[model samples]
Target: MHATVSDHRSDVAVLHLRGELDADTAGQLSAALAGLLERPVPRIVVDLTGLKFCDSVGLSAFITSKQVISARGGWLSFAGANPFLAQLMETVGLSRYFAIFPEVDDAIAAAQI
Candidate 1:
């Protein structure tokens, strides 16, 4: 998987992810996200439109990130996860734990809030 992190605004950062998010790539994502969380950014929007697949490890990464950000008084959200990933999130009962948006604009708006 390929992940790029960009500053969306003053307090919002966007992480654009492409390709599969599995065990191997999940670690990379985690490390990158850890760096983001360590910063002062208050919100992070993960754009998963280009993501092709995700495994349990990826789900763990998302959940862990959410917890860490929440503890830091920030938020972690997802955008454009596609239908399959959406279903998977629901199946795993993680839909309620995250703010999933249909578009990057919506996610950005939420992040700014």
Candidate 2:
């Protein structure tokens, strides 16, 4: 997968992901997200519009990320997840740990608050 990290604002960061997120690419994504946690409270929105597939390892990465971010007093959210991914998240219980938004704008708006 290709992960691009951008600073949305002073307090928010946006991560745009493309392709597939699996064991081979999970480390790349994890490294990308690690850089955004320099601040005191990191608010991140992961844009998954271009993501095609996410394996269990990839899902585990997200769950682990949520734990780390939360422990650091920050928030990690998801945006633009396709219907299948949405259902997968629900099926695997990721929906409980993450606040999924319909789009990047919605997640950004909510994060800003």
What clash count goes with each model? 0, 0
Off by over 4 Å in 1: none
Model 1, 7-46: lDDT tens per residue?
A: 8778888899999999989888988797898976358989
lDDT of 2 by residue, 55-102 (tens): 999988788888778888999999999988999998998888899999
Task: Tell me the alpha-carbon RMSD of every candidate.
Answer: 1.1, 1.0
lDDT of 1 at 62: 86
TM-score of each: 0.94, 0.94
User: Superposing every Cα of model 1 onto the true structure, what RMSD results?
Assistant: 1.1
Scored by Cα lDDT, where does model 2 land?
0.89
Candidate 1 residue pairs in clash (backbone atoms < 3 Å)? none
Candidate lDDT scores, in order, read 0.88, 0.89
* Top lDDT model: 2
Q: Candidate 1: deviation at residue 53, Å?
A: 0.2
List where candidate 2 sits over 4 angstroms from the true fold. none
